[model samples]
Target: MAVTLTDVAARAGVSPATVSRVLNGNYPVADATRRRVEKAVRDLDYVVNAHARALLHATSGLVGVILNDIADPFFGAIARGIQATAAEMRRLVVLCSSSADSSSEFAYIEVLRRQRAEVVILVGAAPEDAAYRREMAGHVRGLRAQGARLVLCGRPAPNPHTAAASVSFDDLGGARALASHVVSLGHSAVAYVAGPEGRTTGTQRRLVFAKALSECGVSLDPALVVAGDFSRQSGVDAVRRLLASGASFTAVCCANDLMALGAMAALREAGLRVPEDVSVTGVDDVPSAQDVTPGLTTVRLPLEEAGRRSLALAFSGHDFGSPVVLPTELVVRSSVVAPSAASARRKLA
Candidate 1:
């Protein structure tokens, strides 16, 4: 016979009501009593039917995780961190990808609300449209009005205020550090291959790169700066565009690892040797960075910690503040080096 709640109750010498409370993490039950019920369930190998339990209690012990794209390593790392934390807290997770589309994001929010998630975490890539920002904020407010907590893992839209909790990193500082480091290596004419200009990560990194170059008395050649979606192909194309513009850059800095890797491939095919011919650097030290031949010289951000902090804020019920900024360190690898005097002479010529 299948074990039931009554069986557990009988083994623990408590009412089924007490077992329900302990299992649901709902009502306050004495530690001793809770332990006894848990032990009985374990002894009987009894598992609460999640569907039945949710139907009875109006909650499924589920948390909703909404993201623009789960495939992005940065967001993927965040999701993994959230999953680890949720496992410890005995919560279930439901993942939804919005693909950076406002309609898709709003749709997922509605679905999560209808599903009765206790909390909703949104891993948004900054959206460009102001109307969409307002729409997203309104949905978040509605969820709060219905008593569900909302947290943003990445950059939420700017302008329309969101009272929701947020966890983010210092894109500007991290990008500036990477760019400044390259410029210090005597690369005065450096090209920037930026991600989508509207997204926070892309915009902040590009802006910081510009600022850092300016501080070093080097101006980014407008022809050498190209912005595209954060894809490997975009990186390759951006580099091609830069080369075709007749600008001589001893170094190229990409916004992300994918772009950096792509830039490397493009350079290799064009018979240019990395670091030897042109120094290259990328952001986000993704797993591929360590595996790629020559290894990537890039900036490493604490992506996993960003995810964990997002969950912590949700659970702690913390109020809104400036987004959390994580420290970024530059990883020196075979991809970057001091420009050769020969390359330097080319710039002078």
Candidate 2:
């Protein structure tokens, strides 16, 4: 039997009329009550006769894009590409920001599924949670079954055989190249500031960096590896903690440009010169990377191209049977240099 409004009302501890009003948005409801009703609906997997609505409308004329943080340059660039392609196709783009929260991400996916969007694009890294992955895989299959296409940009596909499409960057290779470059610069004592743990991007990058260091015969100091969110402030705090630990390091590698900028700021405040007193490097050579004083040496990923490719794949209506992997290039700037004798002596002291 289909789950009815009365079931949702009973689960939410509200009347059937209250549940109807909350779902229809035709009557005022308390925020708490609305949240309860929504949770009940999601928990029950109630679709409210979505198939009937699909038959009546036949077309949503909308494409949905889900992003972690729209303000971040990385995400913003991808959004620009997606929006441009969507506008050219005359399909309105609806953007939803999850702010890197798993619950919010799932909620946005559910909302897009209910609207029967023509295409749904999910951008950015996902948390490494088994349950979440399974749930997302189910959601992807559900959307496809409903005649909606799903595209993953900068995110890994849940199942390789699924109908969903994906476009991803070579994160591990980029991280490995960056770390190898720093190691070649004659800096053995290097500090790494990685993105948040449990995130695929951060985990893969950090793992590759460690492997590169090991291959170069340099042991990674646990004290020098700091966990940080992908933000300027987190980078700043990571550096401060490294300094307080009195770990001797001549180079600091950040997972992203924003954190690298923060690390540079902290180093300067501590009276250190870039690539002179200590070298600093970053990944994701964003637009600001070149503008920053003593430009940041980093890895450049084709973010906009990935976005465009994802949208194109969605419109093609054919599964390519494999994801499109974009290449990454190392951008050498003024941020990295050989350790001078003076800096080497200071590190020893």
Candidate 3:
């Protein structure tokens, strides 16, 4: 016998009306409750009636795109690519911003499911939580069962079995390359401005930076490592804390270009000159990185290309043999230079 609405409600521990509300998108539901219902739908392999399925199919030309922050150039570039690809296919993209909140992300997923999106693309760093991962996996499976594709862009695949495709940046290699470049500049002591903790992107970059430092025989100084939320303000605050700590360092490395801009501003306020008093590096060479005075030396992630490829993968409807890993390049610019003799001597002091 086919799974019924009653069976799904029983499996999710909710009333049938609640499951109906979640599936029909006619009423509001709590995030946790929505996830439970989605999970139950997937677990029971529930299928809507023929008439309901026909109605959903009739409304199909929508693709959903979720991002941490569309205001950030990093995500904006990807969104552009997604939009460009979508335009060619005569499909409309429903862009959703989660603002780095896991609950909001899940809620958006449910909304897209209710809309019966043809494809859903999730971009940016995902929260490192077991329960969230499990719920997301269920959502992916549920969406696929309903003829929608789920793609992860710049995020780790939550479940190998459920994700239709995954596209990720080479964050580890990029961070290692960046650190190596800074170390080669005769700067032994370097400070780090890391992205938010518990995020895979930030954690991977930080770990690789530390590993690179170790390989260069440089000591990992906890005092020099500061955490930020990949925001300009967070970068400013982190740099201020680093300065107040009085840790002597010749260079600072930021997880993203926005933070690098903030770090540069803070350094100037502290009466320091870029590359003269202190060198700085950043990841993700956003447009501003080049326009900023003394252009930022950083790692360049192919944001737009990654976005385009993700959409292509979604459109192709082919099973990806493996997750696509995009390459990152080390972009050397005026922001980085050999330490001044005075700064070098200060390192020895």
- TM-scores for the candidates: 0.79, 0.86, 0.91
Q: Taking the tens digit of each residue's C-alpha lDDT, what string does model 3 give over 143-254?
A: 7767787788988887656657888888778877887888887878899999899987888788888887788778668889999999988888988998887778899999
Residues 312-346, model 1: lDDT tens digits: 78878574766666777778788888899866875
- Best-matching candidate per lDDT: 3
Q: Model 3, residue 216: what's the lDDT?
A: 76
lDDT of 2 by residue, 103-214 (tens): 8987787677657688889998898888878877777766765578888888777766667888988877887778788889899999999989999778877887888788
What's model 1's lDDT at 315?
79
Report the error of model 3 at residue 348, Å.
3.8
Cα lDDT over the full model 3: 0.87
Model 1: what TM-score? 0.79
Q: What's the lDDT for all of these models? A: 0.78, 0.85, 0.87
How much is 299 displaced in model 1, in angstroms?
A: 1.2
Which candidate leads in TM-score?
3
Where does candidate 1 have its weakest 10-residue lDDT segment?
52-61
Residue 341 CA error for candidate 3 (Å)?
2.4
Off by over 4 Å in 2: 1-58, 159-163
Pairs that collide in candidate 2 are none
